[model samples]
Target: MSSAEKGLRATGLCREFAGRDGSVRKAVDGVDLVVRPGELVSVLGPNGAGKTTTVRMLTGLLLPTSGSITVGGYDMVRQRRRAALACGFSLGGDTGLYPRLTAQQNLSFFGMMYGLRGDRLERRAARLLEEVDLADRAKDAVGSFSRGMKQRLHLARALLHDPAVLILDEPSAGLDPQSAASMRALVARLTGEGRSILLTTHDMREAEELSDRIVLMMGGRIRTESTAADLRLAAADRLGHVVNVAFADGRVPAELEHCPGILGEERDGGTVTLRVTDGAASVEWILKTFPGRTTSVSVTPPTLEEVFLDLVAAS
Candidate 1:
């Protein structure tokens, strides 16, 4: 699809800042990213990995040193207002909302800023309050809400304009497990309604569960991009599967390492750990080879955390 037809697109995106000592720092290097209609793309990275910088550039909140951004066909730099109208972002922190204002008032204020008026603004705000499950707290001051509640309000405010694309920066950053789960459910529901989303977060499990695709960033550049399942498979292919075997007498057989599918082996106390190309096949071999000597065995596939760590280390 064409750039304009796409939900959001950025090409050669870069941002730089001058250090206190007069040296130039590239907060974001050249990075190209896209989120198609109805797709939720998660940008995963460690702290200082350019995620926030990229998001800011995409949202037109910060100017890029070089490159271009398009939101629903409008150039984010040259046609900033139109692009801004096409996208809404929930950038968590203490800055986005008026803490002293009620939730409804905040939404009304932003809605007016978006050129919404009268009945249209009120209806939209009401719908969003219910959508974010904050209908009962609509009149409560934002400063009185919990972090999770505030986040929900942030989401509601972002949706006030009913933009085609949503940018969420660590939506569940400091939320408790239950609160995080609620946020995730809200995200899932939004995407289900065919809204495109660009989510930047360090939460690996959340990315793995919610994203249609994941872009792994490191040191201001895109390290790799893939579907969650593909990334996990790649990790398993590169690092192999982990197999733990227990022995009855606390002794591991020396010849186990030489098995066909066994790539590496280590012994720790009564447990023997094996890295194998084919976990099931290797386990079968081990069971048959050791017979009555083996007491128990377990195999685990590569986790998303393991994959993310390996990719970051390599980068």
Candidate 2:
């Protein structure tokens, strides 16, 4: 499929709400985004930075004040019904399952909404329950399931129609390690089947692990969007290529912020913790400057957390 047909596209997206003070609050501001089929893109931002608002607009829950959105080749606004059927979104709280209904019944109910019935609905529900590791509990009421179990059920519900695009908001929230891992695996599996996924998460690790591209947002606008490797390379350029340090005798170097390529340095006892720009070449210079005083040295990979924080800080 072509780029526009593969997934979702939003251009010049903006939303404004009348504030309590009778002023306008720009919840989303001129954001542009694209997600391709079989790709998992993570949208991230600080609180009130328009992440949820953006999702709401993309999923057709709210209309954008300006700009256009398309999902699975359908215009989100002008072709609302087609767009709604093309995407599945779970906003992460309750599973929206009927608590009194058995797991099988709940799945069947949602399946029927998607026009699956009889043997097809039963087969699909059974397969989905197994996919979510809830086959054993299919006959039990959803209320009897754990929080994690409910979350998985929600995933199954979202997948009932086999939407071409999936938007998951904080899918791993409140899940235990095993449950969260399962959810991530499921997301990966769906994307492998050529389904596009737009996921939002406060969990940095989840974003780093699952997203093909990460979009960092702050103050209701995107600060940057790139792959994990691209973000690290960009941050390295700003931070520095190398760092050299000298320590005073008897006392380790105190916290010092020096050098064009160095971000910051902290001292503990006789050790200096340096946050350097680049790893390979910077270590060579550090060894020459400190010599024996350096004691020990470690080179670290750039983490998404670091890049994300730096982007937000710059914004």
Candidate 3:
């Protein structure tokens, strides 16, 4: 099959769990997602937003309550065992790696499970260890590895089988800055090799930097989905460009609140906070209307955190 045909696709996948009092909680509610060949998609959500649940369903670890999913053109539920071999997944925690096994041994074991043996397995394991910068530590017991080292090993394990699709949940959850950067670069390389990846992360910077598209989930539902630029643009229009105005006379700009598109305003001492809806127009008006009274102005660009907070708060 073509790479695109071998990509991951899901439609209305839902997972409901039984709760106390016999009530059903829809942890993953009718979620639809797709990952194209050579693309990196990020699923962004707060804790308990079903991000992990979604990954589990996609990776065939958990069966969905409803809806259909296909990975490498195989039914996720019906052909689960076969589908599992066609995809690689790395989840949070240690992923149950053999503590006594050396790094190369660990990779060799997983590669063997995927039907690789002998020189081929050893070569792949050696290459992966080198790719992840752990070749020197190939013979070190996993127990002696740092958190970041373990994280890299987990990734190496995922790719040992050369699966067509990858599913990762919080891949860099507890890594240092350097490790996280390396992890991201590795992900980029995987996509460069035409592998489709679905990743869940709580890191806004990671999501913004790696994702071709971001899906934001809340309360077991998709809140919104957009590219990073589009999200930033929406946030700017909704909350407007923040301008910090310094008043020379120590009095609130008399006509500040009267400006059109001024959504909200606050004054603290001689500083004024104006939430402008039309950032450019409102800023121009401020300059013309309060030229002499305003001493300085600074604009604060909306961050991913701010956009997410406003979205959640409003919902």
Candidate 4:
């Protein structure tokens, strides 16, 4: 895609910090990222993996030590104001909102900063409050709002300027399951409206479910980028196949212990789970060794969590 058509792009992004021990540390190192129009791309990494640092630089909150950022065809560093207008950021937590102000007041205040005025500001604030399901509590103090409510309000504040690109830093952090689900649904809806999103989260399942593409970061650098499905498949290839078998009488089969193609086995109650290199060969040998002993069998693929763990371990 052309530069003008791209929602967000960064090249050779890097950040360095002065360590307390009198040395320079690289917080982010030579990372390149892209978010297409209407696509939701997640940066998945553990704490200190530079996810937050990358988001900060992308949103023009922190200048990169090296490299460039462009949002909606505007250079983030040189055209800071234009880049800010094209992008909105919701850094999850209670840091961005006023504790004493009502939800509507908070949105209105942010709208004014975006140069919105009079009826337009009021209308935008009202619409966003309703959009984030905070309209009913628009008059209530933000300090009294629940964590989920505050998070939703933060998202509403981000939309005040109707930005083409949205940047979220751990949007569901510290939320309960239901609240996290609600946040995910809202994010999905935003992408459906052709808004490009760049999300940073440590939750692998969240990334797997919500993102169109996953960028795995580790040790302050991008390790790999692919779809969640492809990463899981790669994990399966690396970890091998898993076969689970259960017997009717909860009895362990002694002969199956000697079965070929079984790399390892675990017995939990009546069920036997085998980690094998060749699933088909292992299953065949297992049934042959234990004839009528097996009551049910299942072969399962690796999950995204497994892939993430394996990738982290290898890195």
lDDT against the true structure, per candidate, is 0.89, 0.83, 0.86, 0.89
Q: Candidate 4 — which residues are off by over 4 angstroms?
A: 1-5, 20-22, 246-252, 258-260, 280-296
Q: Model 1, 1-315: lDDT tens per residue?
A: 563355888999999999999999999999998888889999999889999999999988899999998998889999989989989999985567888999999999999999999999999999999988999999998988888988888898888888988999999989999999999999988988777899998899999899999999999999999999898877887888889999998888787777667788888987988888888888888889889888899987777889999988877
lDDT of 2 by residue, 1-315 (tens): 577575998999999999888999899999999999889999998888899999999999999999999899999999998888898888866657899999999989988877779998899899999998999999999888888888888888888888999999898999988889888988888889988899999899889888999998888788889997788777766654323344546465432343335667766555566777666666776665556775456665566787777777877
**Cα displacement (Å) at residue 48, model 2:** 0.5
Kindly report which residue stretches of model 3 are placed more than 4 angstroms away from their true locations once superposed: 1-4, 243-275, 286-301
TM-score computed on alpha carbons, candidate 3? 0.86
Query: Would you give me the overall lDDT of model 1?
Result: 0.89
Sort all candidates by lDDT, best to worst: 1, 4, 3, 2
lDDT of 4 by residue, 153-262 (tens): 99999989999999998899999999999999999999998888999887788898889999999988999999998887677767877889999889877887776666
RMSD of each: 3.3, 3.9, 3.5, 2.4
Spell out the clash pairs found in candidate 2: 240-261
Of 2 and 3, the candidate ahead on TM-score is 3
Candidate 4 — worst ten consecutive residues by lDDT sum?
1-10
- Give the local distance difference test score of model 3: 0.86
| lDDT, residue 203, model 4 | 79
Clashing pairs in 1: none
Residue-level lDDT tens digits of model 3 in 1-315: 655558898899999999889999999998988888888889988888888899989988899999998888888998887788889988856656888999988888888888889999999999989999999999999989988888889998998889989998888989999989989998888988888899999899998899888899988888898887788778897767777788888888567888878778889989988877776777788789888877887766577878887887887
